[model samples]
Target: MKRTILVLSLAFCSLAATAADTSKGAESTAPTCPVTGKAANPAITLVYEGNSYAFADETAKQKFSDDRANSLYQKLGGKTAIDAAVELFYVKVLADKRVNHFFEDINMNKQKRKQKEFLSAALGGPIPYAGKDLRSAHESLGGLNDSHFDAIAENLLATLTELKVDPQLIEQAMAIVGSTRDAVLNRPAKPATPAVP
Candidate 1:
């Protein structure tokens, strides 16, 4: 009778330990995102259209984030080059009579800082953007059309050239600006009326 009771107690302890192990393993292996849900590429989708997403692998995600940050820092002339580029850009924009009106109500100092943050983040630098999204911020500007975009792009090109940035890198940066065309021109500019003949 004593031997049978000891055997029964050992069996129960073993079962309890096995159950605990299984629960722990399940917790560790659980999926971060559901298998049937949307993908995790934020840039590919429109601003507010997608469901929530998660990185498929934590380690890979960290690597990607780090690479982006480093690339942006290098692309924007590093820490020192950013200030020069920003200054040049503003100067060029201010000198252009056609687009100066758009910037008339802006606080130039604040805008310079915001542009720095934007470039840093977009190029994968370590800075977090404090500025509003392009569409919302520019929506109130009347007559912001493709011509305005072209003027901005031209000014940016001239600024980058003055900063001695590589032509290829400048091209790459300009490509980013082109991507925001749709967002920046959210509304059509009103056409000017023709004089009677």
Candidate 2:
């Protein structure tokens, strides 16, 4: 009789352990955003909570766009501010003798359009980018060295400051840009040259 009782107790313990494990897995896979308290779409929920490369949801996306525009407008003192910042960025780039050559043949109008679209998209606005892929565009630049990339980054920060954009918004925008560093700087290795006979 005592042996049978012990067997039943062991069985109950096993069932309890299995139930606990199932609950844990479900909790880990749950799709709620800790930030906005909204249920994330199953497809994108994993992105927000999973790896670093995940895209933002619609709410996060809109927040980014609105924050950028507001920051730029306030930082630069309104529409006039954004215009001045843009002008300053180009002027600084053109003055850099080493890298200026890269932009010598560029179409300013088209470049401006792309910049606007890129900024809008980064901020989570409705604009869909129509520009060339970033890697393809920079591939022929023969690899942007660290200094060259730093110079551009500095100029952008300066422009943001001159426009009087909020510090937090500027930081957020910079972080977004930083995420692309690897793709921008590290090109795929060139194919091995054929061996000479």
Give the per-residue lDDT of model 2 (tens digit) for 62-181. Answer: 453344334422232332333345666777778877578878889987776576566555544323466766676677787578777777777778766654556765676678777666
lDDT of 1 by residue, 35-144 (tens): 22334443221110012223455443454444543463554444455656777789899999979988887999998988887876776553357789888888888788
Candidate 2: minimum summed lDDT over ten consecutive residues — where? 1-10
- Candidates in order: C-alpha RMSD to true structure: 22.1, 21.6
lDDT of 2 at 81: 33
Clashing pairs in 2: 64-123, 65-123, 75-163, 75-164, 75-165, 76-163
Model 2 residue 33 distance off true place after TM-score fit, in angstroms: 24
Which one is best on TM-score? 1
lDDT of 1 at 127: 38
